[model samples]
Target: MTVTERVRPGVDAGRLMEHITALAAIGATPDGGVTRLAFSPEDVEGRAYVARLMAEAGLAVRVDPAGNLIGTRPGIDPGAATLVLGSHIDTVVNGGAYDGAYGVLAAIEVARTLAERGVRLACGLAVVAFCDEEGGHGTMGMLGAHGFAGALPPGIAKVLDERGVPVGDLLAAVGGDAERLPEAAWAPGDIAAYLELHVEQGDVLERRGVPIGVVESIAGRVNVSVTVEGVAGHAGTTSMDHRSDALVAAARVVLAVRAIAAEEGVVLRATTGTCSVGPGMWNVIPGRVRLGVEFRDVSADRLDAALARLAGAAGEIAAADGVTVTVEPGARTTPVACDPRLRDLVAGAARERGLDCHHLPSGAGHDAQIVARVAPIGMIFVPSEGGISHAPGEHTAPHHLVWGADVLLSAVLRFDEAPVARG
Candidate 1:
């Protein structure tokens, strides 16, 4: 049957916006943004508020060992494999109201609407609020989703929460057991599929005048830290021909990064967002320079090739400047392709609702990427005003937010009705 002909539950725009407004107020910034770092007292309070909402939606709520908040609404068949919907609530410092908040809050609205209208389906529904998806700490980012995928990186043991609390205490504060974090992984088939709704976080949808984006893939990323060493000398006295300048060599490497991403036929993205130079003096030559470079693409093979070329370029530049350079690789995550069936389902939902739909690849990373390892994952995106995100200026129109949630509601019902939902 066509999506339009099927019985569907509708999302309440007023209620959804009210939830967004309330959550935004928890870690409200003076400049109309939010800063609820994961496990911070503010974040904990936000989670409690969401927990109350989940309970009010008539779902049984609990926190997993990895600090993922989950609320379940049972299906008619007690043993049905669940269909999961959610996104993280933790925001980057000074982030806007929508990035991850809309997904989790909207998932709650879906369950609440279903309960309020007495709608039931064959597949159980689960709503999750994942932890720490936007952290900047080394190895501490994407902590919750990785754990939920049963692949938590080992470095988390050395990390501290936003409040400087140890992992054990932080988990305990949220009713999670750090020692049992490994148990957070669900065996295969426990979750039939995963779906997330998020802001476009880029200008694609807005630029194209499309209200929705059906994500094709989340990019695989490789980050490297490069340190260039050279002899410090008096800038004025040193002969230009004989001097080895670290900054000069580092500058070349940065240029190479830009060139690689912008070059013809190169599908990979490269960036050097952070750089540090030592011996800061107008008359003194730089002795050491440190750079943070990253490469991202949907193809792991392409990422590998781009990074290899970068290393070659760095070595050549260092040799030309008589300096030594070392590249230290950092956290790497492979690209994740969305399930074709689910992608079509999202597109169909948008079409049925008369919202313009665009298909695109996510340049930024997401929890849906990690969750893809265990379940078929799909993502729906709404436009971000001016393509801004992870900052105070980020925004999506109120109508766009409602459209994403409404499309999500339609998609969830479509999933439950599919023949493959049986346990």
Candidate 2:
């Protein structure tokens, strides 16, 4: 189908941009960034605004026990499995405007366009705004989606935030029943497919002059926490040859991380985003060092191999430096491949619109990765200018945003006609 032929009559570009602008104001920062951390007051207010928008768009809205916002529009066949579309709304501290909010607001726009035209399909449509995707309060990320997928760990209710408030209490504060979080899990077959529209968060599409990206896979991520213990001494008293410096060992590990990732392949990403030295003093030899290491790759085998190398390297470094090195693995999420049929549908949507589209892999983690456990999933990416994300500079041109929404609307319409299998 050509773009002109499938174009919905009333897909309002202005209204869509308006929604983005309005939501961007909730946690608006003086630096032109946003700070709506999960479960924060700004997050709650933002979700409330979304719920209101969902209601005004004529959908029945509800907040799940895990705090995910769900808005459902019944189909002609009410018993059919649902077509779910959405992205999270919570942002990283000082995050960009478009990262999570665009997908959500665009999903609403799709529903709004359909409702305005009185179009109902064979399958139901649902828009969801998952909670805590950015993992504030030191909790594992994608909490809401994890719960909905029946993947949330037990004792999650006891997990505390920075203020020592339990997750259950926080959920309550946001109008959710954390005690019933497990009840929020949807049966594996309930949803026919899941789709998300998000910024590319990279320069790939923009550099290629493409407006759309059909994601091939979402990369798997493994986080490792490392601590090195060594003797602390006065810098002047401890000669370089006699000193066992934890900071020096940690630095070697960091360098090894970079080298290992580079040796693995272009697809592998390794980072040490956080590092700290205890008793940090200009005149003192560091006694202890802590580092957070993260590895991401589309191939599980490659990630595993890289992880093994990292552990081995850490051990060797510790032995050479005369320090005790401990590597504690944290969250590990497997790579997710988008359903082939849905990928084609997304490409078709772009083709019909005469928009250039590229097939790519997402280096960043997303809620769609978690939701894929329950349903066949697909993702669409609009270009992010200058490859900027998680910062105030993140942006996609208004026209690009409109085009992305149009493509999403087209794909959703196509899915409604002949939905894919849930598995």
Most TM-score-accurate candidate: 2
Please list all clashing residue pairs in model 1, or write none if there are none.
none
The local lDDT score (0 to 100) that residue 374 gets in candidate 2 is 91
Candidate 2: residue 179 Cα off by (Å):
2.7
lDDT of 1 by residue, 1-423 (tens): 545554353688899999999999999999988998887788899999999999999999999998899999889998888899999899888988998888999999988987887778688899999887886332377778988899886756546755566776766777778888889897668888999999988999998999999999999998889999998999999999988999999999898888888973354578998999989788999999999999989999888788778889888998799999998888788998988889899998898788889999999999999998888899999999999998889888899999899899889888887733322
Candidate 1's C-alpha runs over 4 A off are 1-9, 136-139, 158-164, 419-423
lDDT of 2 by residue, 291-346 (tens): 99999998888778877888899999999999988988887899999999999999
Best-fitting candidate, measured by lDDT?
Answer: 2
234 in model 2: Cα distance from truth in Å?
2.1
RMSD of each: 2.1, 1.8
lDDT against the true structure, per candidate, is 0.86, 0.90
